[model samples]
Target: MREDDWLAARFEENRDHLRAVAYRMLGSQQEAEDAVQESWIRLSRSDPASIDNLGGWLTTVVGRICLDMLRLRRSRPEQAVGEHSPVLADHEVPDPELEAVQADSVGLALLVVLETLTPAERLAFVLHDMFAMPFDDIAPIVGRSPAAARQLASRARRRVQGNPDIPEADSSRQREIVSAFLAASRSGDFEALLEMLDPEVVVRADEAVAARGAASLVRGAAAVAEHFSGRALAARLALVDGLAGAVWAHRGVPQVVFAFTISEGRIAEIEMLGDDDYLEQAELTIIEK
Candidate 1:
């Protein structure tokens, strides 16, 4: 067989697996099919000789594509559930067979839960927990260390299992961790801040915060630690949206909110919210330290 024919055969062999991976990453079957097709396009363009494991390589490519799609979906305004309901009134018959197959592959309830997770967390959980992919392979895809990838998967797993709410004891422990992080930031204790942060911790700010010259996104413990060192002196311990977090208030009115996602006793994600609309909608309770 010619090289192109051989490559086509190899790709055909892995199509179903790639489609399954993409479907889990993206809840929409149409999007999953698109992701798989894109992966095949990439494979065809690359030098096959360099690929020792085509299956693994294809999986990684599909993962990256799905992650991008998920992020893009999040960036846009959210649509209400059933907004895309089939327009059966137009006399278009729905395919019961196809619907059953899709439902059997992944339940709608689980997909709803997965949609709540961040792109990185969803990818980590789907690849490591669902597909049995190792964290080492997943780390590079999500741009995190192996340990951090594991943490993401663990956190996602907890959410997927319908245990999204932190237990009372876990909440108290998280409060202590957030308090320590605040103290370290106020005192410019960079080392201490690093200790409480995951090696691949991520910090994201809203447009309002970023407009003030703060980064929209920062990754890595060292970078995040450096950014927070000697800062947050005015930020007080608070509960933002029922999570252990902090708020920087002016005259008792919150000007900024720091929502933290803690896992494995380390801060895995921090979201800086300065948007007026979000602040107004969030339930903020300043905790007396």
Candidate 2:
């Protein structure tokens, strides 16, 4: 067989797996197909003799392409839900019997949660948590250290899980802590705020919030406490996506939402989201005191 023919056959062998990875990385099937095609193009240009593992090489290339695509998407204006829904080709209809099975296996809800993650965080979580890829392998792709890659996946996992199955008692405790944190912030009690936060607490803000003068990232309890101290007066206790959180609203519309990650009774992380698209998708309910 010709060299190009041999490469094409091998590429076909890995197409399904590559498509699956790309689909999960990018939540759009069309984009996933584009990424897979780009990977094949890269493979075709490279010398096959120098490649030890074509599958691994192709997967990494696709991952890098998807990462770039995700970053570009984030840079653009946010799209409203259902604005760019995927449309399948006429000849691409699936078996009726497999519809439910595919839907359940894909878990569209999980994909929605994944959309909230940053590009690096999404890559780390998908590759490490879902594909069993190690942080060492993910580090180079994300341009972070292995430890940093691991941390990204850990943070993403926490957000994705959101503890929907948390016990009522635990949920109540979370609410209490969130309430206390808000109270301390409103009262400008820096010490009280610090007490509620983990020593290594991290705070992240979505692009919109950051553009509105909020810091994109804040680390350490002291810094986080200082940032929130005397600042949540306009924010009210709320259940954000079934998790104990808070929101700041203007004329009945939420302008900012605070999602907290509580660990060992302390605030381990706080994600501030002000993106209209994200807020519209989130289910927020005010908790009356």
Q: Local distance difference test, per candidate?
A: 0.83, 0.82
User: What does candidate 1's lDDT look like per residue over 1-289, in tens digits?
Assistant: 9999999999999988887788778866667779999999999999999999999999999999999988888787576423222222345454453355356645667777888889999999999987899988998999876645766787788889898676799889989999999999999999999999999999998778888888999999999999999999899999765578999988988888898999899999998878764576566789954
- Candidate 1 matches the true fold with a TM-score of 0.54
lDDT of 2 by residue, 1-289 (tens): 9999999999999988787788778867677789999999999999999999988888889999999988888887576424223335576665332233236444667767777889998999988877888877888899866645766786688889875355789789999999999989989999999999999999998778889899999999999999999898889999876678999998988999998999999999998888664576566899953
Question: What's the C-alpha lDDT at position 78 in model 1?
Answer: 77
TM-score of every candidate: 0.54, 0.55
- Residues forming the 10-long window of minimal summed lDDT in candidate 1: 80-89
Off by over 4 Å in 1: 78-105, 165-289
